[model samples]
Target: MSALTVSQEEVKRLKGIGFLNNKGTDDFSARIVTVNGKVSASQHRLMADAAEKFGNGMLAYTTRLSVEVQGIPYEKVEEFQKFIAQEGLTTGGTGAKVRPIVSCKGTTCQYGLLDSYALSEKIFHRFYEGYRDVELPHKFKIAVGGCPNNCVKPNLNDVGIIGQRIPVVDAEKCKGCKKCAMEAACPNGFAKVVDGKIHIDTENCRHCGRCVGKCPFHTTDESIYGYKIYIGGRWGKKVSRGRALDIIFTSEDETLDMIEKILLFYKENGKKGERFAETIERIRFENVERQLLPSC
Candidate 1:
């Protein structure tokens, strides 16, 4: 990749303001960039104001549902952070080991089972410690979702959390209406209408909750079963989607703990600059899974 061209005129202008590099400031201190997302209009505006105060007013958005404000100099970083804190935001994920985790809200959908906001906040707060400075062999991405709508694309991240549901049919109330069957609610074609009666093929059903959504009488239930963990997915350079590690129980806090374990394991055992996928390919999936989930 080509080196960034530092505008001499811009540098001179900044230096003239006495804010470029103060006494004792590291000459090579990296520039600070701020970011937020499409949230409450108020927060979005607050982030924009922060960019005006701390950066060069250049903003960039990512597909992962975030915005980046760039061109911040070194000396004013502390002041910039203080200013952002007033807006109730922070910038730990912009630099390294773990980036800001992306997730979708459960409030907007009936299919959603877990609280995504709580999950996002918990992951963000807990994972920030030690991750900012820790170097990764390659950039890692994490995405979580509340259901099988694939909102976060579970199969396409270094780590992913996907929601699942197992539906229970009340045959007495079902009336064999076949409403669920007609909607094609089951991706596996598990539901069928025969003899004017709705029959569910349990063996083929993935229990994705669509049938429940379509049926008025059949009740829907969040599967006690946890999320399906995926490993080794990435997009850039060596693009590859992660494969399923295993089905884990849905404990948000515990899941984060497991993620930390995986990250640490990768750091200790992976070759320098090897991504999670590359590492998995080298060490073998079973060994990686054993390290990630020893009990199962």
Candidate 2:
């Protein structure tokens, strides 16, 4: 803290590599990259050792799921990086590229329909690491949620992927029971028996899959799993709720490709210093959607 030795320019350069300057001190925090907020037990232990060895002996967690070793002097940055590197860890998640991928614990949760952890792993390897060098108009953030629970706040990111389970009814198997189990199981009352047939209000059904296989007659016995994508969502000083694409991607490949296409669109058409939401607004969501969606 006595006499700043590191110049402002040098600090900016360090930030590009995931080192954040500590206020009122020459110390910096090294942000270690993490995928879906998960790391091996050995990785965690190595970070703990690095925190005490080169940092202030304390570690901080970022909202994006990266770990930070706080209080490392400017000179010890390289040493800290190397120490964690032995465990195959690295420091990054800054700049105008894809930020860290976030995954909710939806896959393990009772309501979860998708494997949030696995999907996020694909995103991290495919985009976060794959697009590491591809600069965009601004930082791009991605989040994967396992279900409609929105535990990860996917709608708040630039690109959000949420899992969905749409119930498929076998009308021939339905028996319009006097006391319908599907009706009782449906949290939203979207399922009902009318005139010897079970009807699902497509407009109101949340596709939560809770009612699937609930009917005694096996009427609602099957379901379709899909991913709902939202684009152009932003949060902070200015907030923009992402718009859901018209189609529900039944294949993971389509969802992943959609993400890449959106990134490409932004990279080519977006203006410098503008967020993806702003770009979408400028170009008009209607036009953007038409180009991105396969049907259009």
Candidate 3:
């Protein structure tokens, strides 16, 4: 192998700008920010051009839905950034700030209860871009899952948002039919038929919406769509499953405000070099919850 030439100081600076040193080489990988895991077709072409002209003609996808162009010589880093900038694309998803968000395909997924792309895109602009320059205690990650299927593993991120469709059970409308569609629809076995009506064990329900519209007499015909937020979740070496907030938010604006509040709280209270999860653990979730949820 060859000896390293890039100084540690330069590497650290470049890393802040989303460039990672290619071990033993002065070359770097340019991590392109795709906002909410999405890019326009023209931007796609621009990235391809950047790879061929400046990088190693290869692009790799990140777990956070970022794109990395490998083997771009150090000298071309600035030029690479400028080239992508023409299409409104930029390189950088690093540092102890808000990282790029990961979104599930809830927009078009059949089982999706909400428009995940829209939600993630909204968050990208509100927090990711809005707080891009605001440094935080540590890297904060956000993931938007379409439903409880959790394809994007929202619960494993610093903060996660999953869609929910809680069934509205009309007990009086239930006919207590011998052959119950509710029983067949419920995957959790919480929906059961009793004397003259249907009952759902709401406490144990995941609110997956599977039981919705599954009754003969329209007992479970409607559902209330909402979002379930999980906080203090972390992944990687030492993983921690995030805990869900006590209430489900039905308004998008309300949810966005809550997210902003969480970040603001962490910014003011979290110790430097500590992850959000660590801060939550050290401060105790109850204390943090009180601050995040002032109304309830």
In candidate 2, how many Å is residue 87 off?
A: 0.4
Top candidate by TM-score: 3
Provide the global lDDT of candidate 1 against the true structure: 0.63
RMSD of 1: 6.5
Sorting all predicted structures by TM-score, with the top scorer first, yields 3, 2, 1
Off by over 4 Å in 1: 1-43, 53-58, 71-79, 92-96, 169-184, 193-206, 213-225
Q: Give the TM-score comparing model 1 with the true structure, all chains together.
A: 0.72
- The prediction achieving the highest lDDT against the true structure is 2
Q: How far is candidate 2 from the true structure (C-alpha RMSD, Å)?
A: 1.5
lDDT of 1 by residue, 197-256 (tens): 667776556546676646665443323545666788887656887877665556666788
Q: Work out how many backbone clashes candidate 1 has.
A: 0
